[model samples]
Target: MAVEVGTTEPTEDVIDVKEVTRAERLRSMVARHRAKARKAAEQQRVNVARRVNEWFTSTDVTDAELAAEIERKRRREQHQGERELRDRVRMLREQLRAADENTAPALSAQLTAAQAQLQIRQDEDADRMKVSGRDLVRARWMKRATRIGAVGAGSLAYVNGVAAEPLLALLSLGAAPVAWLYLGREFATDEAPVVPAAVGPDGTPIANAAVPGTPFVPDTLAAMGRVSVVKPESGRVQGEKDLVTALIKAGIITAAQRDETHLAGVIRPSGPGWTATVDLPRGVKSSAAVSRVEDLASALRIKKSRIEISADTTDDGHEGRFVLWVANEDNPYGSEKHPSRLIDADRWDFWQQGIPLGGDARSTRHEMHLLWSSLLIGGLMGYGKSYMARLVAAAAALDPTVRIIVITGKTGPDWAPLRHIAHQWIAGATPDIIRRVLGVMEQTIGEMQDRGTELDRLYEEDPESVPEGKITPELAAKGMGPVLLVVDELQELLDGAALVQVAIEDEPEGGGRAKARSGRDLMVEGFARYVRVTRFVGGMGVFITQRPDADSVPTKLREVCAKRASYRVKGDRSAKMVLGDDAVANGAAPHLLGEASKGVVVLDQGDEQGHVTLKADVIDLPQFREICLRGRQLRIDAGTLTGDALEYGKEDAAAAAAALLLTDCLAGLNAAGIDRARTERLMELLAFHHPGRYGEMTRAQLQAQLRDAGAGTTKKIGAVDGMANANGYTREQIAAAVKTGK
Candidate 1:
């Protein structure tokens, strides 16, 4: 029996040892291969994810959408990985069950490894609870409670043993409940500090921070005071190079583009943020750049509302520049403080009694002198042209000595603020209304001519009394006051409206439309002809029109007017039409102005530089009405609220009509140094008005009448061929006699 057992043991031991060695070697090889395969598969999946993520650089999709897509892809990969792990584990278990007892150990080892891998996979999928801020807080509180309770209990035991005081023991025992409280692991929940959501310029919240690997999360989220945001460092403007890189990354500019497209000028601090003057690319116009200002601002990571992109173009339209005004805070214009009141006597004196239109972009007051300067204001619709006209009228109204005549052809509520103070407020563009306006214009011209003669007589009488060869503050104070002739929507009148309608009796025998003439002709010949010169005679005209065409706002009138302010217009053509020929060339690109730049205008007030940017005051309807009320009250108190159409007595009307006739007809006819008797052509001109009095009277009768009224004079005045001695009425002589009431 011993010999047999020895022989069997030797054979079995040899086979078992060989089998163990072979199986162990196979298992080790399989383990290495499995590790290598898993690593290679993971590397392949990482490569695919990397390739997919690279699409974000060129994709136009938002970051949030891209993150969602990446998350979906990762979820898909996770599910596939779990399925593969399950298949591997099932195959390993089957192989272990089919193996014989000797090789079973190797297969079992493989199965165990597979099972462990599956368990790790399942554990990951189980959504294990991570230690949150609340847990950490509770743990800290528990530790502190334990320490305090231990101290309390020790103190209680010591007090009871040393002092043997019953009261202290009872208090300590009751407080020793701290030990029981500390033994409890749970703690009441408290509000935890959390990262705040970031917001965009439009107040859109950016959910850019959550758990790591979550969708819509940033690579690095930072807390900036109360604003928790992604890439907070990128919000600050570093330099031009950084801006250029951002632009390129934002697809606003290509790297191949030249420096002009990338902003050639240096950026400097202007108010809140830096301002840079960038020359647009050769092919790109400034208007194009202005259009994309929002995109540019977004690329720079700035608030879109805090950016100002003003553009200037050359005459040839080949070159242009963009003035980029970027501010850290919103509302750059709000930073400037402007006076609310329109009338400041001190500022008025500094402006030589000019009107304060508004403040410029630099917050400096834009005081325009309408005394000896006509104004041509033109702009697009809704660009504050009518509002500007109201401002002028309001300014005139504040001065008791100034008269306001407003021609509001718009027929809208835009001029409601000026109704209280307007002297001759014409509100329609009908034929009869325009004809009446023409009559008003004719009457104003006649009055201006009369004032000119009056001024000349005053100067001749006393040069010191008439400081300049025009109406002074003293003259205006003395009641020979100023008149603001505001014509808004002048295009309506110039669009072939009626001028002066003649009656059938007054019409000539030619039988044409004799009485009805075009208003444009009468305006060009009569009104605009003398409008500029009348400023010196206390009558200033403001021609405001949305259409700045040759017919609407004639070039002749534009040439006469020394000051022009234009708002956003159609293009450079319209800007030039309103401002001047060199407006666009000199950086007055009204075309680049937009509704976003409301109240911004390009003013050319006879400055050597073409035009300047004037950010007009924000005159709301309520404020305007208040200003009008104040002005009206002022005029009423001063007793100088006389208007062109105010009710007057018969004597006053006759005197005013006689003065108009003397200057408009007599003086104008005698301007060529021609001598004529007062009873000849002068009486004839007067007889047309007072036909019943002097139509058939003799020259002797007219001379007697004038001498009785203290107006005629004997003078040697004639042309070279027709020199004669006669009784002629000089303007100064008539003015003096009329003033002295001789």
Candidate 2:
């Protein structure tokens, strides 16, 4: 390497190897350490400055945000309180308006004090708002001061060479004002003005005053004179608005009538539902609402069958008032059947307590007074017409003094249980059955006349006993009992198919020959007469028919029936026919009842309220039979069991048929307007009227049967039809044979 001419052998610059003293080495080390400490100190100063700036900036932002949040919360709370106060005022006003005179003064005082308190609270809120604004301004200024102080102290510490310690102390001191602005200032601010408690006229604080019947006890002076803050029971408050809206939408009321139409009282609990009284406009009758129940239900979001609308008859001047009952359940009558009250009772007093028919929609028990009123029940088939008829029969059967007569056009078992207690039980739609029905009618009429005669005698003998000229319970107890005549499926006897030949008394040109007439007319006339005459003398008629049309139940008969019940019918026309035009117009809408509403019926007993809808008690076959057996035992014990009940299954069927044939012959002779008829003509008449029974009867056979029936010996008689004299029988002989059979 030394051999190169210009390289100078890659010379190394030699450093001086100085061996330093201890003091010199220590100085070097101290200088290095001091430099390192200075760098760290600078970093600490930067960090402190950054933290102080951050604290100031964040504190300013947080103070502003906190003020805004506090204001928002205060406003929200204030608004809620105001709204609640307003609602309380409204509720108290409503209660005051509805309060009675006795409670009105107290309610007025409470209202006055509530108004005053509400005003005070509003004023207090306004004052608090103003005070809050001042405090907010004050807090903001203090925060700015604290921020300035923190910055000034840090700047001073940095300038004076005491950065870390003084800045830390300044931050600590600044926290005091920050904490005061955030927390202590709230306590230092002026408090809200307190409201004075309301005192009654007796100088007692209303907050301390005990309210009778109410559980209102105020805890605060501000709560004095205010209504109970508890919410209204159930949905009454909200339901009122919904009801009004629904009514308006249903066209039950006009928008202009909204003010006048309101709930009369609080919606209270009823059976399976809630009941409320709606006060409609003066010109709007309750029937308007009742007729539009479907529309109301639709608007109210409920089932039509679950809405029960009835006129409020409790007040005389309130035709616009009605009761609205809304059920929560789908079927308001419930799923289970309501058994008859008589099921548990051994006997019933028809004259005293009447019959416990069933309960109503409100679970209120209802009774049917069968003493002086005749009931006319009509509905579609299988819609409780026969069941109701049997209910009446069962009620009557429970009373041994009540003589029951069961006659059903249907030969079903519906009326069979009644046979055990019935004085005269007849079932069928045959010609013979019609003849027997007429005979029973005639006998009932004769008995009614006899009863009238006996009552007249009683009046003559003891005027006090027969003051009302009506049968008394005492008279009924002494063997002169009430009679209950139930005719189920009455349309069968009052239909066009039920025909008979009746003598035309006015048709003198026809030589007293009979003219064919609808047997319904005869039956209607007889029934009308029976109901008209017998209702006054301890006789109650219960006529039930599925077809409640004009032809089935004539107006002549329907008008006389004082009590009427209509089950589910085809339309309003049928309901009107059963319940009367007035009843239907007033608020009776049996047609609105659904087909599934079997035992439900609209009952109109000529009440002021027009009609009431209720579910009839169900008395099944077994219960009916049990009741009948008990009735039979009671009758036996009282020695009152008679007629069909006495010889229910003991009589010979063949002999009874023969006796009934003889009776039919008498009825046929009467219809022909002839006192005497030849045996052949009588047989022909019987065969023509009742062809199924006597279609193949020969003259010899008729004579032999008549002789066997002790209907007197056959003799030659003049034939009315320009024929030769033939062996014949007289009406007197037939009537004699009937009496002999009895």
Candidate 3:
């Protein structure tokens, strides 16, 4: 922004422009920054559109009915072309080597013939723009464009007739580099780059645009689906480096070629195992590409298979993802994909948002909800939902602020973990429990509404107040903490007509003047509105369940489930029902559930623009087990556990693991970013109560246990630590403890 200023001295008669006030300047700066960001985002979208258009116009990629088939053809052609050149090179080298071995005329002839072939290959390579050649062209173009633009401008100035000899002399000043580049000789080999035939929007090749040997690039695994740094080697299995060495000895890959040719990256331990990446030479066939990805999977002891890619999974079928966690005994079923693997043809339960298997780092905690936003775990029998729920349950156990409540309809699998972390674990995701839970949530909702109202009042009262989101738990404690409601396999809640009926009976019509709104139809509608508009509460309404459809889910629940997580559906239309049309677009074949995608899910919701392939993250079962098993005794005062105290501390760790082995298991959990403090507190209680094999209690054991439990060591201290870390302790716990202690 600019402003005009008048000169006080009229003699100096010069009007000056001045910048506005500091606040205005700051706002202007912010606006400029935002504009720049918006422009960049727009440019990226334009790029994607352009790429999509290019593909759609290509011949080989235009067969929408058989896009993968077209991709396979192109890949085969490309691979053969590159391979022929490579084989010719190898033959030439071999002929030369044989000639060196013996003075044989046949070897000499072969060597000469090989050299001729080499010459031809080199010529083709130069024109074909091998990666190295592309690098040169890219570099030269940048330089040439810069120089020509600069020198051409100056030369035109001279051509158009410059003023004088003195001016002409200055004109050439600082233009030497431009002149050199402009006058430099350009070079081009005989070979020309063959632009690929355009691929259609459906990833099929366009007849006119199809390139002979282009590799099929299906950025998403459509049809089928599907943590940690727990190295998979069980002592007998080779360590990463040693295994790589062994592979080299076995002629799987040469040691010299490991980093550049075959596996381009170093071997590293990933969640539950080890893996490496291979960057195949350009123009490799689709089959070869599959072979490369498969070879790595084989080396890593992972299942090799093909997954169908869904078009609704973002425009390119490679967006909105996070993980690709492998399913095993511990996490038998998952809600969505995790960001671990880049690809998977295996059974998958869940996938993460913005994450792919074998592509990048593990998913972060804050992203868990967003990535699994489309996931909901629930089943009728034997506990399938628990497979993925453990991840959520375990997370809450570690973080106190994450107050998790697990309500399962059936007991086996879903009811396994969370006995420790979940403040209340219901073996049944039952109607009665739902009723009780609804009653509590109703209270919390009323409290939150009142708080929202109070915040408005405060703003009116002062005209300067903290924003709603800025309302901290501390402030909320003074008012009401944000309430979170998580129901597993919501089908049970749907079944509980009696409990639901009672709540309806108590519900007052015409907006009763009660402290909190009842769990009535209107209330459910209000909840829907809240979930849709308010992040603070929608964030709170991150409800989980096995059934993820309108029918399986109640009308009340469905209205507010703006975000849903899906594992696998039974059929194509079912997948559409679960993932929605825009998100799970896997062509005629629905990709999320069905026979093809057992574990993978197409995560979609009302607000989600589209779905994408996401591999689910692997859970740390050992750590989860430790938390649940020991969380029984790790007690803390909810009232006293204020501010930072709500955070887990060292005292918590020693107490929990005092009875367990001293392997860096705790470290693994922490490095994996599992709940560290709560794990400790829970472990502390387990050690005190179920002292493991250290069962033969001695005076020494008691002292050691007490010390680990944060009791002041020295013989003088008694059962204060033990008492503090007690079972069934609540708000009135201290009073009872004090009564007993005294």
Give per-residue CA lDDT, model 1, range 467-488, as digits (tens): 8787877887777777777878
Q: What is candidate 3's lDDT per residue for 428-469, written digit by digit as tens?
A: 535456565555555545655665676666667764444544
List per-prediction Cα lDDT, in the order shown: 0.60, 0.73, 0.40
What's model 3's overall lDDT?
Answer: 0.40
Best by lDDT: 2
The residue ranges of model 1 lying beyond 4 angstroms of the native Cα positions read 1-266, 276-339, 343-353, 359-365, 410-413, 416-419, 496-516, 524-527, 548-551, 621-623, 644-742
Ten residues in sequence with the least summed lDDT for candidate 2: 208-217
Ranking by lDDT: 2, 1, 3
Model 1: lDDT equals 0.60
How many residue pairs clash in each candidate at the backbone level?
A: 0, 0, 109
* TM-score of each model, in listed order: 0.46, 0.56, 0.37
Among residues 3 or more apart in sequence or in different chains, the pairs in candidate 2 whose N, CA or C atoms overlap within 3 Å are none
Q: Which of 2 and 3 is the better model by TM-score?
A: 2
The candidate with the higher lDDT, 2 or 3, is 2
Q: How close is each model in CA RMSD to the real structure?
A: 32.1, 27.7, 34.6
Q: Local error of candidate 3 at 431, Å? A: 6.1
